[model samples]
Target: MNGAVSPLMQLLSEVETLKKQIAESEDPVLKESVGSTINAIVAYGQEAYSEMTQILDEFETFQKMEGLTEEQRNSLLAQSLDHFKDQMSDHEKDSFAKSCEDEYKGIWESLDGDSQEFLSTARYLGYALRMRGRGNYAPVINEMCRVFENELKKKIYNDYIVQMTQKQVVDMDSNTEPIKTAVSKKKKNKDYFISDTEMVCFIEALPSVKNNQSGYLSELKKYLQAEKWDIQKLSDSQYTKSAHNYIDNYRNDSAHANLMDEKKAEKCDRQTHKIIKHFIESKK
Candidate 1:
């Protein structure tokens, strides 16, 4: 039976056994207290198992990858448990943290390159949330924009450049001049490094590298649309347009004044997470 049963199933079976024992006991008050306790345990276990199932479903793709081991699966689960730590009791948090940390160093090592980066970014976002909770909102928002612009945007721009120039073979003396001129023009016109408007334009210019679809552009446009942002009116660098605008506004306002409050910071934190999730999903 043990061999055939899943861990959750085994837990449920144990709950049933406890219920049976309670039913057989003769002490009325003892039965009442123990019955309530058993119900609570069963409810908690069911909730935990449901969450674990959802996490496993999310990682189903990872599990299908070649060379994944049982040990890696367990580690992945532990790493995932970190996200739910806040919802757990103090005792559960302690136990979960201890288990996760034992194999924490190897957790990312066991994942694929993309998975590793995804989880690392997510962990960083968690840190950003903690910082926001501690009332360090400006720095966290600034860092979020920096990651979006410098890391994600720069990566996409460089990849696009490589893809566009991949087949060209330039001569050292003659042909190289045109290639250099083109690159210079692309950089000047795209100007993604300077501001969010240029970054949006740069993203718009990029051809889709996957299935004839630009996932990054699509995801970004959806976010901008939801924010009621008009791309045409975003020509001015000072204008607040995209989610990056929130970062810029917060930075500028906070530098000269104490304008950032906890509520606004929490909203910014949520927007940052949404932006990060878009970047992560686009990579997939």
Candidate 2:
């Protein structure tokens, strides 16, 4: 969420101006011009503003008092989805289990503020039920797989930042096992390989945001070899290459294809939730 410019600020300024303008403007063409200009202002704030009307719009009301914290904003998102699922008569044969209600609340709250914000995109994103052509199954699977991979990156990057703070690994190195072993065009089978694309996306995509990503890949490898971390601990501080292998293989088969049906969507979400709990468990 863009806390710098909240929805309440927009309402106080832009909405009031629009109301005054609408009252004063008598000509239809002039009113339409004014309306379009206000709409354009909303558009410039963020493209997601259009799609996430329900969740994002809530900020306008609450931000009047004070802007939301990362967790509060995420809670709002979770609440919106949960409210709909519970109130609206949606086909239960389509929704993902543990992705709603108290189950989701626990998972969402378990994460730290930053991690909650990082993972909240899963809440409002990829409305598989809304996908017209592809049906509900494929999109749900795709979204869950995507969230899993991104969560891994976030967790690994978070650990990497901590290591830098403590001067553990080279002040800027990350010990991560990527989703793919090789940087190939193919993601379907991917066979067995490790690629830096996932970590690179975090490190290089925005230097200001990922300030800890300073050292080269070679430094991390050198540190790992010299320190001799066990394979289980070496894997993004979660599990070994085998865990990564299993995830990659499962995701490859589940996502990137529309072969699965609606029931599989629930299965994907439920199974993913279980594995993510393991991934986020605090390692001693």
Over 56-174, each residue of candidate 2 has an lDDT whose tens digit, in order, gives 33423333334654335334434544333332223321232224434555566554443333223333233423322334343334445545555654555433333433443332334
Clashes of 1: 0
Model 2: per-residue Cα lDDT at residue 53: 49
Deviation in Å, model 1, residue 33 alpha carbon:
43
For residue 74, give model 2's deviation from the true position in Å. Answer: 24
User: 1-284, model 1: which lDDT tens digit per residue?
Assistant: 00112233455567778788788989888788878877877786667656644643443333344564433543453354344433444543343334323423433233334333333333333333342244433333332334444443344445444443443433343412433444455656642223443454444433332333433344344444454544333322332245446545643332222434556655654565455444433432
What lDDT does candidate 1 reach at residue 140? Answer: 30
Query: What RMSD does model 2 have?
Result: 17.0
Q: How accurate is candidate 2 locally (lDDT)?
A: 0.42
**After superposing candidate 2, which stretches have Cα over 4 Å from the reference?**
1-101, 104-106, 112-136, 158-242
